[model samples]
Target: MTDFVQSARHTTEALRDLFEATPLQRNDHLSARYGAEIWLKREDLTPVRSYKLRGAFNAMRKMRAARPDLGHFVCASAGNHAQGMAYACRHFGVRGTIFMPVTTPQQKIDKTRTFGGAAIEIVLTGDYFDQTLAASQAYCRDQGAHFLSPFDDPDVIEGQASVAVEVLDQLGRAPDLVILPVGGGGLASGVTRYLRAAAPGTAFRFVEPAGGASLRAALEAGAPVTLPRINSFVDGAAVARLGTHTFDALKWADPAQVLLAPEDRICITMLEMLNVEGIVLEPAGALSVDVLPVLADEIRGKTVVCVTSGGNFDFERLPEVKERAQRYSGLKKYFILRMPQRPGALREFLNMLGPQDDITRFEYLKKSARNFGSVLIGIETKQAGQFALLAERMNEAGFAYRDITGDEALAEFLI
Candidate 1:
């Protein structure tokens, strides 16, 4: 057997010391929808509700095994990684200090504390991730504690390879295509490395958040580069720069195989999975599944596996997710209307509404002109076609209106 294959197998066996293998289940809804055999590696079902624990556990285990006296570990994360490290620290009976961004949600902070219990100390540092990371590393260096990199270490990479080992064993055969969500590329690098050695024929597609396409950027630049700006909506997978170690492993990947998922579109997929399949996936977790429709033609009749990376979704974001999904699917709209300042004119505008269109929000703004008033309106409809009909009716009535639904600036300020 190849060295990588043997190493990954050994790691997989060792993981049983921490927790059982996460389930790989055939997804009926997705399989039927795409006309392909679709399986989900349910990493969300892991103890910390993410595949992150795999690498954390493996890294901690090997560190302790090699240096029996090493009793302190440190890491910086605002979400899943923190929980993973905390859980691993407790498992290893070691002291760990986790630094987190001050802006991290209370829900995530609570979850991390619960996972680590007394074994891990939670430190709230800077407002940004970079600052938190720097603080953690500095603390580790000064205190002589081992710093656990979230994705950029060789040990973490090897630990992540255990996922591929379990996948091959669980599926009985290598899938034709494997869809992976990319952040710093740790999971993708590790899984691809092991799979390439074990099942040379399997193909791969890498998905990243559109606002944070670090892998695509690195591939194009022939090296890792930091993005000037990144949208952190897909926090788990929205890394601004690919890690050096991870980029080295993933450098050979074809740029075309890297797909970008828009943050809004991901919300639609999250809602679909939650409502249809009863699967609760965070923005990053739903990425692999979100891209299935984009690859419907390519994946049809092929055995495909999508790694649902994490399920650490905060339920408080449900309303925002639903709103974004509605807007993306054209079920919701916002518009600015020039309405006449008269009672009968308001009645006339109300008459133009189609049967399926319902007014969700309406506000008449004070105007200097006595004859006209500006109105902000939010409408919900059963179908996108209803909007065209409503627009036509408004035009016939000589009502001046502009659809602000897709105007990001206006929508952000007004909605």
Candidate 2:
């Protein structure tokens, strides 16, 4: 057997010491919709609600085995990796220090602490991830502690290969295609390497958030490159740069096979999974499923597996998710209307809305203008066609308006 294959199987077998392999379930809803035999590798079901624990546990285990006296570990993470390492620290009975961005949601912060108990200390630093990472690395050096790189380490990558090992064992044969979400490329690199060795003929598709296409950027640059900016909505997979080690491993990937999922469009998939399939997926976790429709023709009548990476969603963001989904589906809109400051002006404008249109938000700046006032109106409709009808009615009635739903800068400033 290849050394990688043996090591991956051994790591997967050792994982039984922490938790069982995540379920590999055939998804009836997705299968029927896409006309393909679709299955989900439910990494969301892991104890950390992510596949990160696999890498975290494996790296820590190897380190401890080699250096029995090493009792302290350190890492910096904005989400899943923090929880993964915390759980591993408690399992191995070692002290760990986790550094997280100050802007991280309270739910994630609390969960990481809960996972590590007294074995880990949570440090809330830096508003940005780079700052937190630097702080953690410096602390690791000063304290002489083992630093855990979320996706850049060799042993961690080997541990993540365990996913492919379990997948092959569970499916009993190579799938026609396996869809993976790419962040720092740890999971994708590990899984593809192991699958290439084991299955030989399996195909691969990679998904990245449109605002954070690091893998695609890296492949084009012939090296890992840092993005100037990224949309953090899909926090788990929205990496600014792919790790050097991970990029080297994934450099063989075809850029054409990499698909980018828009931040707003991914919301639609999250809602569908939750409302239709009763699956709770974080934005990053929904990336694999979100692109299935785009690959509908290619995947039809074939065996496909999508890795649903994590479910550590903060319920407080549900309203925003629903709003974004509505906007993407054309079922919702926002308008800046210039309303004449005259009697019955509001009533006349309100009369232009169709029966299916419901006003969700209305704000009038009466003080900003004397003859005409600016009104911000949010409208929700039952069907996308209703929006066109509303626009027609507004135009016919001589109402001056601007649709701000698709205007990102205006939406951020006004909505």
Candidate 3:
């Protein structure tokens, strides 16, 4: 075996001291839906509820071994990475300073603190991850502490390769295809590299959030390039740019092999996994599975493994998740209607609704107008085609309405 692959195997064995191998379970629900033997590498079941712990633990262990005097480590993260680092710090009996964005969810912040306990200090700084990252790097330099990157380091990448080692050991053979969620590319790069050597015949598919497709961008540009803007809804994998080290490892990945899962569409996968399979997945965690439908033809009758990257979902976002899912699936819509100022006009609008159509939200943008008033309305229906029928009825009734469900600017402000 190559040195890296051998190191990865050793790392996987060493990790047994921390936690047993995460399950690689065949998901019947997904298998039936896709006509493929679908297995989920349940990284969500890790001690820190993420595969991130594997990389963090391996990196920290190697670092401490090289420099015993390195007593402190630092990292900047808004979610899973922070918790992973905290868990690793506590395990290694080394102090760690974690810098997180001020706007990070309380659940994540609390989890990081809980994982670190007395072994780490939390610093809430800046508003965005970039700002927090800058602060953390500066602090590391001043304190002469090692600043651990979440995915950009060789040791971290090698550590992440342990996931592939475990997968092969548990599955007893190579899967026909392995689907990986890509962020800064640590897990994807590591897993792909190891599997390429260990399971040379296995194919690979890379999934990235559409709003932050750093890997796709890199493949297109032939180098890592920063995105002009990134949507952070899929917080764990919403990277603006691919890591240099990670890109170097993944540079040969085919552009066609990378799939971009829309952020809103991921909500549908999250809800399905939660309601049907009783599995809760954060947005990034659902990426690989969410892209399965796109690869249905390619994977049919084959054994495919989708990495369930993390499960640190906060129940508070359930409503938003459902809303986004509905919107993306065309089961829900928002519209602005201009109504005549006449008694029973509201009743007329209500009568236009089909039996399956339900009004989820109704508001008056302008309740009092000389001749007409503007009404902001949200409708949920059992079928997507219901919207077309509703629009036709509104036109026949002489009602002027504008569908705002697909209007990004208006939806951002009003929806």
For each candidate, give its TM-score against the true structure. 0.97, 0.98, 0.99
lDDT of each: 0.93, 0.94, 0.94
The sequence of per-residue lDDT tens digits that candidate 1 reaches over residues 1-415 is 3887787788889889888999999999889999999999999999999989988988888889999999999999999999999999998889999999999999999999999999999999999999999999999999998999889987898889988999999999999999999999999999999999899999999999999999999999999999999989999998999999999899999999999999999999999989989999999999999999899999999999999999999999999999999999999999899998877998898888888889999987657779998999999999988888889999999999999998989987889
The residue pairs that clash in candidate 2, if any, are: none
How would you encode candidate 2's per-residue C-alpha lDDT over 294-366 as one tens digit per residue? 9999999999999999999888999999999999999999999999888999999888788888999999846
- How many clashing pairs per prediction, in order? 0, 0, 0
**Model 1, residue pairs in steric clash:** none
After best superposition, candidate 1 residue 108: deviation in angstroms? 0.7
Measured over all alpha carbons after superposition, the RMSD of each candidate to the real structure, in angstroms, is 1.3, 1.1, 0.8
Any idea what lDDT model 3 has? 0.94
Q: Given candidate 2, what's the lDDT at residue 357?
A: 88
lDDT digits (tens) for residues 210-306 of candidate 3: 9999999999999999999998889889999999999999998999999999989999999999999999899999999999989989999999999
Off by over 4 Å in 3: none
C-alpha positional error of residue 225 in candidate 2 after TM-score superposition, expressed in Å: 0.4
What are the clashing pairs of model 3? Answer: none
Residue 100 deviation, candidate 3, in Å? 0.7
